[model samples]
Target: MSKTILITGVGKRVGFYLAQHLSKSGYQVIGTYRTPRPELQQLEALEVQLLQCDFYDIQQTEQLIAKIKANNSSLRGIIHNASDWLPDSDSACSISTIEKMIRIHASTPYALNLALAPLLQNNPLQFSDIIHITDYVVDKGSKKHAAYAASKAALQNLTLSFAAKYAPKIKVNSIAPAMLMFNPDDDDNYKTKALNKALIKQEGGEAEALRAVNYLLDSGYTTGQTLKIDGGRHLV
Candidate 1:
């Protein structure tokens, strides 16, 4: 029987590519998106199920897990790719904005994992996995983007906590990626500068992200570890 995987915020970019690639790899994919996007119709046409659930809403998060559980289907894995990148101006860096960032990036995943722990434990499959997509900036710490970095740092800690608690049954890992698929229309100079910072001196793409996921899934002995797909960005 084919395994089922749920990918949150899979309407575009890395999340979308993950859903598409995993589906092609023979896993049944259920993708969640906040707003309906026409591009996702292609995934639906390919028989990938699409569900609308806003991670920002706690009640909706619970309902989404409940609906999946009611189907009597066991989830093979979950990829938390949902994230918000709201830029904060000098005046707008208030408590509310920080709270929102924490709620969306850190709290939501933590809550969802707690709520779904029983379902994960009940899976008949002996091996299961969870991949949390985090940003490379968490370690470097962006000067202007403090909230985003702080939230992701908290998330990184949460990933460690979950992995330690869940143990040998459920493997939890994280992928920290840098400069993957920026706006196509942007000039090459910016891209070059970004690439130069990496040890590989080349910008990464969707394939690197997929590789991290595949590694985590295949490496049964690995947990509580983060695979950085940043082309050595942290080296500089």
Candidate 2:
């Protein structure tokens, strides 16, 4: 049987593309989306098992973990690709918003890894991988989305810690992308401003991110690393 992979936040964008990529690549994919979207509807057409879990809701998050435990699915990898990317002003990034960001990004990944270790541990392949979808702001900081950036930074740090603890049995890593996808509502001026951060003068879309995921899954010796597919945007 092909390896089983779980990718969270598959309603659209990178998570959506990654699910299609993995399913096409022959891995059995299980996707989680907070709400149904057209992309997820397509995934369902491809037979990707879909689960609804709003990580912002503690009860729903707990229930998702329970569902995983009940399935006892032989999962080979999990990609933490969920986030709340609402535009936040100084007044908007309230304590509750910050807490939700932390919970959705850091707390959920930690819980899933801890809860699912046993399935990965006992796998006949003897190894498993976990990938977190982080962002470029985690490298350079963000004024507008400080809460989101800070929470992702925490997740990046956890990637290091968990990679060590799970070593020889599981590998933990992250992919930090810059402008992986621009909001369709973004105007030409906004796109220009966003592209200015990249030395490559262009955005690397879901394809680059997918490449990193495939590498992490197939590379035997890589762990505890963050693959920044940011078009060298961190240089600035």
Candidate 3:
């Protein structure tokens, strides 16, 4: 039987692509999305089990954990890819903004890992994974997205802690990427400026992220480390 993997925030973007790729790669994918989108129908056709979850609500998160535990006796991996981009400059409640960011990016992953570690332990291959999808802003603080950056930083820090706690049982790691792809609505000036920040000078694409994820899953000795796929943005 193909091992099962759970991925959060698969409504679109990298998370969506990961779910699709991993499904085709022979893993049983169980994905979560906060909001319904047409793409989810495609995933369902591919045998990807979809769940609706809102990480901000603790009850909803708990219910998701319960559902996973009830359905699967074992899991091979989990990818925390669900995220929200909220600039502090936005006219929202300041405390709410920070809290929401932490809740989705940090709090949700923390809860899921603790609750799902047992399922991960039952992997037939004896190697399980928890991969956090972090952001490049984690290294360089963002003035406009301070809360978002800090939350991702916290998620990265969890990689170290969970790696130690799980030890020989499960491996915990992170992937930090910058501008994997641009939204269709982004203008030319915005794209040019964004591309200029990366040494690679292009959208890194979902393939880059897939490569990083595959490396971590296939490795025997990699844990507690982050694969930086930022196109060398830190060098700029």
Per-model TM values vs. the true structure: 0.94, 0.95, 0.98
- Cα deviation in Å at residue 218, candidate 1? 0.9
> Residue 105 in model 3: shift from native, Å?
0.4
- Candidate 3, lDDT over the whole model: 0.94
Computed on alpha carbons, the lDDT of every model, listed in order, comes to: 0.84, 0.86, 0.94
Best by TM-score: 3
lDDT score, residue 109, model 2? 92
Q: RMSD (Cα, Å) of candidate 1?
A: 1.6
Residue 236, model 1, lDDT: 81
Count: clashes, candidate 1: 0
Pairs of residues at least 3 apart in sequence or in different chains that clash in candidate 1: none
Backbone-clash count (model 3): 0
Q: Write the per-residue lDDT of candidate 2 for residues 53-97, one digit (tens) a residue.
A: 999888998898888778755788889998887545556448777
Worst 10 residues of 2 by lDDT: 85-94
Order of quality (TM-score) = 3, 2, 1
Least well predicted 10-residue stretch by lDDT in candidate 3: 86-95
What TM-score, to 2 decimals, does candidate 2 have? 0.95
